[model samples]
Structure formats: structure tokens, C-alpha cells
Target chain A: MRGTPRLVAALCTVVVALLLQVTVFPHLAWNGVVPDLVLLAVVGAALVTDARFATLLGFGAGLLLDVAPPADHAAGRWALALLVVGYVVGRVAHDHQPGGQRPSYPVMLAAGAAGAFVGTSLFALSGLVLRDPAVGVGELLEVVLAAVAYDVLAAVVVVPATVWLFTREPGPRPAQVTPRLPRRTPV
Target chain B: MSLDTRPPRQRPVRQVSTPRERLEASGMPSRSLLVALVLACVALMVVDLSGGKDSPIAPVRRVVGEVIGPAQAAVSEVMGPIVGLPGALRTNDALRDDLAVAKDRNADLEAELERAGYNDNRYDEFAGMCQMIGDLGYAVSPAHVIGYGSAQSFSDTVTIDAGSDAGLRPDMTVLNNDGLVGRVLAVTSETATVLLIIDPASTVGGRVGDNMENGMVDGQGGFEADRPLELRLLDNTVVPQKGQAVVTWGSEGGAPYVSGVPIGEVSKTFEELRLGTFRAVLEPYVDFTSLGLVGVVVPAGDDQRVIAADCVPGGTR
Candidate 1:
């Protein structure tokens, strides 16, 4: 409930970051891949939120990211796929894990990495199939792997810090219980 | 369980719904991701599958594109300073060489101008068209690009710093660095939004330079990957191939957009297709991902007549 605007802002940041990752980072590329800020943000959002919010976050991030390189055209596909991934991560974590315990850092990392890998791969695959039938699956897969690994490593810290910031509970819980219901509190 | 103080469960309301439950609750198949994705996939498939003709999602794509386009443009703008340095340095060396060569060429041209015919320094073929434009009584007000598609889009259109105050109007042609970028779609007080030819929703009347073959250059802006902006040629009867030039017809007496300006060269030719007929791809003359200067053509009188004429049976003039 409190995260809508923040989530929107994060989505905008992720989109801008991803666009930078594709266009400018090449000038600063390490091994032909750029760090994916969108992945970190998506994973971070999903780690502490429900599926609906996570989906919304992923959609915003994906649509923004697709604008990078000025070439990728399937904007909706990225939005839909990332939404699926984030929603799944949120749903699976909530269903399997016990309450109040955060998923292990490595598990979250792996999940984030895997989702980015799949999402990026699906994009390349879509590009190859829909745009040019000349691209082979293997070449695209390599790029996907590189992008995923780079994003996971770079996002390791950012993701956790953001999740910690947003998910942290700062005050005493909203006093969920009392010995007896007070008739009324004095003004 | 604290005996004295315990919060009652708020109806044990499932705090976070399961993925499957969420999907079901959200109308899984049709409205859920699977269907939405399927529809997207189908749409993309249909566009590529049909080669960008007859797909109805083009307008929807343009809307989505406008959202992403601004961000894309912004990132590119921020990256400009750093990325441009190397290119600028290289250009410096190249320009120095070109300067020496240009000096000799200029000297030769001056001598040639005195000895032979150099008249007004305009190309012969274009001379007629230029004169034609003047004869039409058009008031040409050039504009420059103040903004572009950032990380949000790599679309070819741009925002000119001019607007109605600058005498710019809706549907006026915009150009610079290339032939046709797009027509002015929205105008404000001091600025106007020009829908570039690369926008998925953009459709412009264009012709081939060599053979005078005419067709419509429909936007393939968001159609494919790696091809940021593209245009299609219709009118199956017009024959041209990968190297033929594209330009606007300059019909409205050369008011909106003048004749013979370079739009793009045809890259991919759809030779094996038909349905109302031709096949052509416009490789935009302007590199939209990188643009610095542009011009907006001042609108002529009764501009809506052109829009009306665009729908006539025989197509544009």
C-alpha cells in the first residue's frame, strides 16, 4: 500500500538504467556485457512485495528497458515476460517459505539471475524469430548468459540494499494486540 | 500465543495470494499474463508474420512506444557528451583532411564558375523544383530540434523548439539532416511534437527518386529489433529495389515538405509479396539515434485539403 509511488519511481529508474546499460555501457563494457540495474530492481521489489506489485514493477521496468539500443521492438513481450517472472518469484517465495523469514540471499540471487537470464534470452529469441530468422539460438543464449551473470553480480549489493530499505520495519508493529480493548483513549 | 495480549487474525485473510490463485483470481487465461503474452506474441508474430501489413496493433504499439521513447532519448542525450568525444576527435582529423581537399575543390569550382556555367550554385534538376516552390508562394520557416527520443524511444521524430508562436502547425512536415522525419502532430505554445516517419503510427506519401515510382512509407519503427526506424513501400506496381532513393512528393506546392529531399534508401525489398501490392523498406536518410539539426516546414494554406486528398481514389499526386 505504501509502495506505489516508490515502485513507480523505481520502475522509471530501472528503465533508465537498463537503457544506459545497453547504449552507453558498451563504451565501458567488460566482456561485452553491461550490468542490468532493472534486474536488481525487479528482484529487489519482488523480494519484499506481493505478486501484484511485483508484476507491476516488472512490467514498468521491462517496457522501459526495451527502448534501449533503439532497435528492440517487442516492448509488450518484455513487459509480459518480466511480469511473469517477478510474479512467480513472489508467489513461490510466499507459498514455500514460512512467515517473517526472508528468503536466503543466495536463493534470491539465483532467482534474480535466472529470471534475468530467461527474460533477456526470451527477448533475443523473440528478436531472432520475429525480426530476423537468420539469428541462431546458440549465439543469443550466450549473450543472455553473459547479461544474466553480469547483472546478478552487479545487482548483488544494490538489490539487497533496496529490499532492506523498503522492506524494513522501523517502529514497533502497529500494536496489533492489547490485553483488553480500551473503552477509549483520552484526548 | 500471549494469553493477556494477542492480536486476533484479521480473518486469516491470505496475506499474499499464491501465484496460481492470483492468476485464477485475475482471470488467468484471457486477461492473465499467459494470454496477454500470447496476444503480444501473436501480434508480434502477425506483424512479422504478415511483414507489417494488416496488423491492427500498430496504434497500440505507438502508444507504448511513446512511453518508452522519452526514456530512451534521455539516456542517449546523457551519453552524448562522453560518447561524442571520440567521434569528434576522429571527425577533427577527417575534417582537416577534407578542408585541404575542399580548398582545392573550391578553387577549381571558382575557376569553373568563371569559365563555364555555375549560375546560382543549385543542382540543375533541383533548380526546377526550387523555382516551383517559390512560384507556389510558400512561406518557409525552418525549425531546429530541441529534444529527441531518449531511452524511451529511438523513433525518428523529434520535438522542435518552435510552435504555433513560431508559426508551426499540426501536420506540417519536419526535416533536417535527412529528407522527412515526420509531420507535426501536436503543437503547443513554444514547442511542437513531430511524429517521425519511424513511428509505428506514421504514414507518409513518398516516391522513388530514380524511376518516380510512388508509394506510401508506413512506419516500421517498433516493428523489428536492431532496425530502430524503418518504412514500408506500398503500391505493388512501383518497381524499385534495395538502393532506390525515397523522397516526399512535395505535392501541396512544396509547402509542407519540398520535393526531392532524401527520405531514405530502400534496403529490404519485399519482392515475393502482394495484397494491394508493392514491397519496399526505407532506410532512413537520417540516423535518428544520432541527430543534431532539423527543420520544420511551415504549413501552407488550407492544409486539411492535403489530408483529404490523401484519401482520394488514385492516392497522392
Candidate 2:
């Protein structure tokens, strides 16, 4: 997937993930923490797209999360958190396989856990700096642990599906057709 | 046929171009872009923090609410029954037992009412008595919980289907059937964000049972099913026992909270010896986990108050 189509697909994936994050997942919360589906979606995009594009996607997604109704915290906390997640994930994945191949399952899972940890920690630290009444040492530890565990659990499904969506060829083609190459003559 | 053939030709072209070439082709430097975005995020946070409630970020939040709020409400409506099925099944037996207990209580209440010679006049007298006993009467607009805040954030908040169009504004008290839920923090045309009472940042002035001792109720951060609120009374000498009810002391005009709204009950008490302070833990009557329909208390107008005074036993003739 080249430029415009890939961007559109990434946008759609993030929006859907955000919808699930705010609406459906709250009902299925485990121990008062819902899986960070939007963060996982950013990780998925990072795995499939370049660092620059993934970072942009993460910024947009995080801004939406920040401003979305029911969000009471200062704006841009999630934006910063996810921006780092996208950049780090994209860079690591790119370096791991410069050929643009899909990462292995374990790699994807690790990226998800790492992304969750980075995002949650950044958000929590910023909250502490801002003197946000919600963040304390104990709460921070609990949130970080729960967020990483949930993101990793969700990554098993969300990451692979997102990668396939982004990397899959746009149109169907003949399975076994190979174009003949002109014979190279010594000059 | 032409569209089908295009993908095959494009595939080889894409395969031939390496990731490095593609990155260079995209033009902008990746590291700089990241830096710029990070700076932008930091600026937004700074602005939001400095500006407080009337922040420039309000418009952005309102736009997001208008755009995403409807979608969330739609998804919630469509998915609510399906998602609730398992919990409903698990609680079915418990619900039946509750129904039996409620029926018995209803009969006893009805008999008591009969013995007291219940009538429309008596009902009006009771309402007058309640007002005399310091009931801050406020009309309520009902709404449904459409969405919740991202669980990653430490603050507890929920989006309700009602908003400014429904006469909801910031700081309005919100409550459910059980007890006080929270207060409105922001409102759009069709939705409002409520900061739940259980959020650590939340502090509600409360009155304790019988003597109506004054205290400040503080939220204890995360809303685990069994977590309790911390209440610090102004006077440290008075010790509250377990099961003493708590109610809001109400603001001056009840902008954020109204008087006579039940908050919770004391579950335990603790005294800090060194600080010489008294504190109690309260289990809130409102279940933070499973909020559904709730009412946003709108200060009643004079006409509404008159109507309230004229309220009959069942229906007005």
C-alpha cells in the first residue's frame, strides 16, 4: 500500500479502535482498567507504516482521545504518550526488518507491551508534574501494570489484523503469474 | 478488467522500491516531524493547564464531543444488550432475591401508609415537612450513560446522552436512583462529560447522619468494586460509627451539589494519632462500575416549585 490508501486505512483503523476503547471496552473492563485499544492500534500502524507517518497518526489519535467526552485530564497528555509510542515502535520495527516484512507474533506482542508501557508512563509522569490530583505512586504502578498486560493481551489479535489490513495488496491478481524478465546480455 | 490488471503492474513497482527509497520519497525528515509534533503536544498541555475551565481547548473538546459523542451513543445503544447479557445472567438469581425482599418492604410501607391515613393532603404536608427539614428542591433531567473515559487515565468520568440542549451545564449535580454519581464538567449540544465522585480529584462537602456533622468527602482514586471514599470531618472530636449515612451539604446555590442528596454510608473509621484528625471510610451507594440512567439536577424554577408543592399522592386531577 502506497500513499493515500495507506493513510486512509490507518485513519480508519485508529478511529474504530478509539470507538471500541471508549464505548465497548468499558463494559468489559478487568479490574477497572480497559485495554488501551487506541494505543495498540498505533503500535499496529507503527509496525506497518514509516515512523513519520505513524507518528502523525499517533498524534491525531491521541488528540482525539484527549478531547473526547468523558476525558477530564489536560489535553495533549495522550498525544505526547502515543507520539513516543508510535516513534519508538516504528523505529524499532523498521530497524528489526528494514525489508518491510511483518514482524513475528512475539515481536508484535513485545511492541504492544513496550508501547503501552511508554504511553502509560509518559501520561502518568506528566500527570504527576501537572499536579493532577488523580496520579499517585501507588495508582501509577497499578495503571502501568494493568495497561501493559491488557495491551499485550489485545495485541494478539489487533496487531496482526492491522498489519494484514495495511500490507495486503489492494486488488486481487492471478496467484502464480510471473512476468518474464528479458535475458541480460554481457556488454 | 483494467482495474484488476493495474494492481499486478503496481505490485512489482512497489516491491522494487526499497523502504529506504520510500522514506526518502515521502520528503519530510522523520526525526524533525516527531520533534515538531512532540513540541506541539507539550504546548497544548501547557495551554490547557494554564487556562483552566475556560481554556481555549474547550472548543476542541466540544468539537470532539459533537463528532464522537453520537457515534459512542449509537454503539452503546446497539451493543448494550449484548454486552449486558452475561452480567444479567449472573445476577439473575440475586435480582430475584432482591425482588422478593422489595415486595415485602413494599407491603410493609403500604400498610404503614394506610395506618397513617395517607391522602393527597398528607402527601403535600410531607413535602412541606421535607422542605422545612432543608430539602433543596431541584428538578432533574434524565440521561443515559453512553460512554466512559479511557481506562488508562486515572480520572473517572462518563459521557451521558444529555447535554446543554437538555439544560445541562458545567457543575450541575448528577445522581442515579441509588445516590450521588458525579457532577457535570463539560457539556456539548448532545452530550455532557461527568467527573465521577470516585475520582481522586473530587471533593464533596458532606453531612453525616443524625447530628449532621460536617465533613469533606474525598475520592480514593481507582474505583474498584469495593473501594471506599475518605471522609474528614471538620471537628475531630466527634467519632462516627459504622453504617452512619452521609449526604451532601450542598453548595451556596447548589451549582455543583445540592443538599439532601444521599452520598454513602460510613463503612469504617480511623483516627490519625499524630495529626489528631478523624477520618472515616464510606462505601458510596452509587456503583461506579455499572452506571446507566442518571438524573442531572436542574435548579427548579418558581413555577416548578409551586407544582412540586401541589404534587398529589399518585396523579394530579
What is the C-alpha lDDT profile of model 2 across A29-105, one tens digit per residue? 88888888989889988887777777888899999899878898899999999888888888777776675677888
lDDT of 2 by residue, B65-149 (tens): 8987898788788888987887767577899899999999999998888867545544543343334223435566667889999
> Per-prediction RMSD in angstroms?
32.8, 31.8
The 10-residue segment with the lowest total lDDT in model 2 chain A: A92-101
Q: How big is the positional error of residue B242 in model 2, measured in Å on the Cα after superposition?
A: 58
How high is the lDDT of residue A24 in model 1? 63
Per-residue lDDT tens digits for candidate 1, residues A13-91, read: 5755565566566656667777766766777767666656666677766655543444335445566566676676667
Residue-level lDDT of model 1, residues B171-190, one tens digit each, is: 67666534556778789988
Q: What is the lDDT of residue B80 in candidate 2?
A: 85
Predictions' DockQ, in order: 0.10, 0.34
User: Which regions of candidate 2 fall more than 4 Å away from where they truly are?
Assistant: A175-187, B1-30, B90-317
| The TM-score obtained for chain B of candidate 2 when compared with the true chain B | 0.53
